[model samples]
Target chain A: MRLILRQRELVADAWRYAGEEAGADAPLIATLAELRTDPERHLARRGALGVRLTPVDRVEELATHLPRLALVACEFPGPGEGRGYSQGRLLRERYGFAGELRAVGAGVKQDLVFHLARCGFDALELAPGEDPAAAVRAWQRYEVGYQPGAAQVVLRRQRFFAATPPA
Target chain B: MYQYDELDQALVDARVAEFRDQTRRHLAGELSEEEFRPLRLRNGLYIQRHAPMLRIAIPYGLLSARQLHTLAAVARRYDRGYGHFTTRQNLQLNWPRLEDVPEILAQLATVQMHSIQTSGNCIRNVTADHLAGVAADEVDDPRPYCEIIRQWSSVHPEFTYLPRKFKIAVTGSPADRAASEVHDVGLHLVRDAQGQLGFTVLVGGGLGRMPIIGQVIREFLPVADLLSYLEAILRIYNRQGRRDNIHRARIKVLVKALGIERFRDLVEAEWQENRPHHVQLPQAEVERVRAFFRPQPYEILADLPAPAGNARLQAWYRYNTHAHKVPGYRAVFVSLKAHGEVPGDMSAEQMDALAEIARRYSFGLVRVTHTQNLLLADVRQRDLEALWRELEALRLATPNIGTLTDMIACPGLDFCSLANAGTLDVARQIQQRFDDLDYLYDLGEIEIKMSGCMNACGHHHVGHIGILGVDKHGEEWYQITLGGSASGVTALGEVIGPSVRKNEVAATIERIVEVYRGVRADGERFLDTVRRLGIKPFKEQAYAPHPAAA
Candidate 1:
């Protein structure tokens, strides 16, 4: 059995990925195409609704299904493709999707795990040949960041340059 | 020169430790070469043709005397005895062992320097006018804004992987010394009619396989809105830029394809979505960084007596000095393009000497210009002669700045793996042909730039007389371009005609200059002459049967 990482810990992912091993009671992960075509069918039968977001899919497409999506997973199409990071941010921040936001795709390397975590991915499906233990270790690479992300603090607003803003 | 506090220091130290472990894993075979490529590149380690090259950032071209000494030490301890100052105002150690890079980075951290974001498909070092604080033009200094941008862009998670590298250049003065208009984002710090600070932003300007002049995206953006607006631009580019072809990946192609109006609309929409809560600069934050760049404690000297120096000293003073905002001080330029030497290469001994010079003469501050020369930004007028004499002994007093001989060229076939032909030899040949100082001074402010290939690392497209080395079959061929400027009105040069053989490059340039001297109006610069007369005369003179070429 393969293991995935969640917040820098090697653990079993509750949400099944696109082609991963899942039990009969696992939530059916639907792509954006299927969700747009037949939303009711996907919402009708499952342990939980897991909608997958592609690099090119508009994050707004998943907005209407926010209440039903127990897991929203974003896929990286290519190595240099950065749309997934932004896609993850929108699903978590703009739409207020509080479900398990999972990051999947063979293109998500270990070096990008910290960024993926910062961009609001609670769980990451490691790329083929990438060690899950290394992914867990690599997620602690940066302690501070420039921009404010979903799970990270903004260093620009940190108390170094000046006093913090009023609460 | 923004001082780093504990948080900033901690962040850099953490990065150094991370890279060290990454190196250890790669060497131990735990991480594959494919997996380590981007990781090492983000830390400015490049596996070059011969060895690994490490590029260190020189933010806004400002450096302290102590930093200079540390750089000298790094050079002596590592690969070679010298380091190369690149056209982007960054330093490169062309021959570092891959295993020693982490240790090298640790050494750099002690001086508040790092190699972060110098390579890979990330935002590069923020460049500004070398004389940012000292330029005679009256305006706010641009370094503080550059520092803000630097801090905001450092290890930015979202922007780490883009289609291609992004660059930003800032200029405070209207004179446009920093080549702001030829960058990925050109920021002109301007004041409004109401005396409010703002920026005139330009997007999509770059030089590579395709050279372009940036278009104005925002005419006047309030200073506080800068970060949000920049994020919006980067987000749009990251989502929409081409990923299939590397050649068409730069933001310039996307901006051109979308049309400036539509691109502006997209960026505006994104900016609207991210504003009000996104990384906006607060008043206190801006003041914090600005205070570090406030004017140094300068003694008030109303005027200075005439310097008692020889004619040689007078010539050096005339060419190598720029007017300073302070009445009694001047900005002095040290020419790295001395005869028979590389344009931007400085030895360890020379670097140490420069450190000592800056400490004694210029308030212990030095700035590296985009043109690859060094600037002592706070030289007193009364010390000009004495400084010149000392510089003369050091062989740095080359009175050829802005003349025909002070040309900019890239690390062509000699040290670069991507180069198709040689640029240093071409630069040397041209320099030798115009070696006579009298003739070169007569030629006047001519900008000769060269690039080995279309990558345009040398900024050849913006030169008044540009030379491009092309690979014809296996031998090297040369192409000549004319009438380009990177100042207020940025433009790419036009090719004159057929490409010449390598041996004919010097003769071709000589003929072109002769024609300019012949038909030029009195006191006209080479660029002005080319623009006024057009490329017709140059093409005719260059291609006409030349006995000298034969």
Candidate 2:
């Protein structure tokens, strides 16, 4: 699933909800900052406020808190900051966060989708107007893995090596 | 040495195939020279002043007899009959043709070796103490960890294009034989409060241009986090290190620009973000690598009786060899740096002979020292005379082990493209000038290093009387520095004065010694004399405008 919107537009829209009284029928979408500090406050008001977590200030810190949340948006601050990649890995492998894991950022190019997915981020909120089909094709570009990562390569190598025993 | 397993073997083979393809494409004009430079350098091929020099990684200077023979075979076939062992424990063959390097690399791959990451702006060969596993004072063997790093740093995607070459040296002993303080990153293994082994990681220590001792960035890094922490450091350096100027490209310069505390904080921030979820070094994997270097079974025997009527063997024992950690064993140094000879140059035949002696008498292991000497680590005491006889026949038995004649001179202008004067010729002249072995033995452990230029490639600044060549009016002039030493305690040599004309260099050195000998304060060495009464006296005596007029 893809949500094509500029990160600044999303962030600025999220800020507009700051200190406002929410109605009971508000849609189940929340700003990113509310997920960081006072996660418990948002948790208490979850159903009524229709709140969802954003990039949890720190990945490892949120690993324990992630199981309770149904939706979390993993924000990439820039093109190169890779903290969210590790965050996605921990959410999937350690905490077993089964709900939506969305990636949001500028230059969220199609090539990075495979890595994000491997790290357990299933939804991508790319820069405005990026085609989802083009992003999906990027995931299938590289079939081989030279390094052991959270990607499909490790699993494939394990199966291949297990099937072939040394003489 | 860690023998390559199937995984390592497969990776190297694949890498060779990849490089061969790259070379083919370049030759076919598909890849431009600018595009292909980094690719060739990553594979350890460099187009130097005259030819393509290949620096092969000799991880930690530990090689089995078979590996040495393989190197010898490679040298004889692909290169000139010799290879120069560098101070960083890597071997460089000066005469390998550009086209033949891939085949030479294929030969190295057969022996579980390759030239990957030996040059260019990436991590160079990770050096460690030559006496690592065998040293008496070692906390633990550092080679296994070095090998682990060697694997991690080889062709690392992120670090392939670093601003400058990176060198990391690990030393398990407190003696610092590896010169850990003078490396890009120095890892000294030490026991912590709980008796667990960890590293005191020093960063930014280097010698060239701005020689600053590395500062301790991490007081104690757990052994398990070694790789991840190194990744953190390299990542930070690769991203933030200065690339605007080649002179300021080393990580040392970065650490200098940002104070040590600030640099440490930056590395810690990177580490906090990128700490691997699973520790890279599981105990089992560490053990698997360590098993390859398990100690050989040593014989337990009494000391040998004095040799029958052979004063030469006795003299060699007295001056040339060191005691081994094992009883009835000794570490024998074969001085290839003997005055006038190029440091660490062994003819193919001499190498073959040494290989034979190693297999026969020394548990099939040979070690190359940073001081440009070869060591037979496990020589049995009883076989000392026989070993000496064989070495003597091959001209490898030079009795001046650490004396004046045992000089460490680089291939100055003779072979090195960077040199200004003829270092080998000057070395030969000094050797011929002082041919008396007895006089050399009496001089007692003087390190005279000669570099062809001020680049300090010969480590001349650390020698007792360092000679640096300068180009004066298109003619070579020699500058003398005194009191430089690398072992036990390290000091940079002090310069004497105005440079001497090339023809007057030998006579000037003789005069410096005459002043040293005339001082006559019983048992004071040349360095001690220079240290006591500054270079002022030596400068006045040696640097007269015209010695003939004087």
Candidate 3:
């Protein structure tokens, strides 16, 4: 897996993540399973702790430990599943989790990149061999959006005020 | 017709660019077909049996002369020189290449048109009565509301993908010309005792393998609460509606599974929580939309001289012209279901000619009817003879607007990938067998809907004489249904008996008509007769094996 964090590739040696699942070489990072099962023990020793949440995981439950966490990852089970999107947005706009939020799943493809970012994922963990550069242009597909969410002001509200007079 | 403002133009143009890049990524192998299928379908590109069919949205069935010309140009440039008008008042090109779809969409965007949300799980095109603004019995024009929904549902973030496709239809008149009751959501524009306009919301009426009528969810919802209320229902359906099986994924199925009472309670809960802080649609916004649909500049004058007693013109006058709200104006229907031609199919040249006539006679506006016909909304009564003659030259003057010859049929095996039998040929055979105009006129207002399969795109379940094609051991056979209607009082037809061979289908319809002619009371319609007497009389002979059956 490769991470595009804050519009930059997450290159090795900047931060070595040691986990059998990630096979990463980071010096100190809590594995996803440890963070979920034995959170107190892992919280005692970790420098930077991150937990991966599936579509079923409650973001508010993870918010209980928001002070101890630096990153929270959400996974898309498949292309058809959109629950992860709502999870991501609530973590930012509702719960105010200002830490790094990453989207990790096989279904993370170029078509969903624009929407993924708008729904508030600061980092996108693409599957192996996927190009991070191809999706960099997708976030600018539209200068405007319809529904209210994490990124742009909803167009309806914008129009309502725009249609208002100079006063 | 509504004019596009800067916001609307920007939105459509931006969508075109976005879809173009999506298509490019798909072709470049960056996006897998499985990942790209829903995206393309939402843009109305369908891979048909032979080629890609692009369905262009005719929002609320309203089109201007310039847009019609653009459509004709699209037909000539990217496809064969013809387009099919569907029962939903949209247009479909049957033979556009997959690679040319992006250019086709860009061309459509120039006319303030694109195939956005025209297909797929998103709210499909919002349809309204063909005779909406000009109808004499209408309480309020429904197009403004339809436009509000079009903008709300277009590229709607959460609902772009759903369990199944959703449809909505609105009707302003008491006559129910939009077939609202058979849609996923039916909105009937009604006025309260206080004389304020509101809507009667009907949920979950649909036709497919499961044919059901929508139930009234609310008696009267204020026009301001429309968007918020719709969002509530959609949110519930999107989250809880069945996704395990595609067959049972429509909102109608969910509405049925949980009784309408339970569904209404759930929707009410969502609405109550979301209502106070919902999207604020002020009176200015409502009036802003309503202003666009105000009555066009029409002149008041005395009625014109009737095209004086010419029998053919008189027949055309009786069948084709409808009473308009204005004294000197009338609505004229151009039947695309002429004999020897495929129903709902119009050539590019014919479309161009209609555009010219729409400019000259009817204020440059055209409307597509749910019955798969076209209408000129504000035609002058004085121009009836001249327009009829012009249409006759185009072979569009088929004086069978509501008669048996004016059948509604899906593309069937001819173009649709899902069709099981050839419906266009069956429709042609029936038209040939029943070509007598006088006899058809006597039969009086029969709707014969045909579908190739149980998907019911042909709306076979609601026709007066519904013919459903079935595959019997690899042979084409059709089942006959009687007494269905899509009118003011909507009802589904009942299957008479066993299926009949394809060769006997037309003759069976003729025999059923004979039965209606024999026993019907004076001034009774075919559907009324079937309803009163039940299907036994028609069933006795309709299912009997004909000597010619293979």
Best by DockQ: 1
Model 2, residue B194: displacement in angstroms? 2.8
Best by lDDT: 1
lDDT of 2 by residue, A1-167 (tens): 22343311222222113445545543245564555666666666545332233333445555655556666666664443344665565565446566666677764555355556555666667756555665665443334322334432222221011111111
- Which residue runs does candidate 3 get wrong by more than 4 Å? A7-74, A85-102, A120-122, A127-129, A152-167, B275-277, B304-306, B544-550
Candidate 2 lDDT by residue in tens digits, B272-296: 7544343266667778888988987
Error of 1 at A35 (Å): 2.0
**How many residue pairs clash in each candidate at the backbone level?**
0, 4, 3
Worst 10 residues of 1 chain B by lDDT: B301-310
Between 1 and 2, whose TM-score is larger?
Answer: 1
Question: What is the two-chain DockQ of model 3?
Answer: 0.22
| Residue B459 in model 1: lDDT | 92
Error of 3 at B449 (Å): 0.7
Q: What is the TM-score of chain B alone in each candidate?
A: 0.98, 0.94, 0.98
lDDT at position A59, candidate 3: 68
Model 1 misplacement above 4 A: A17-25, A152-167, B305-309, B544-550
**Tens digits of per-residue lDDT for model 3, B1-550:** 7787877877788889888888988899977788788889989999899988899999999999999999999999888999999999999999998778989989888899989989887799999999989999998999998988888787665566677899999999878899999999999999999998899999999999999999999999888788878877887787678878989999999999999999999999977855433555667878998999999799986777667777878888889889898889889999999999999999999999999999999999999999899999998888888999999999988899999989999999889998888899999899999999999999999999999999999999999999998888888889889989988899999999888888888999999999999999999999999989999998886755646994
Give the C-alpha interface root-mean-square deviation per candidate: 4.4, 8.9, 5.7
Name the best candidate (by TM-score): 1
For candidate 2, what's the TM-score of chain A, rounded to 2 decimals?
0.64
lDDT of 1 at B237: 92
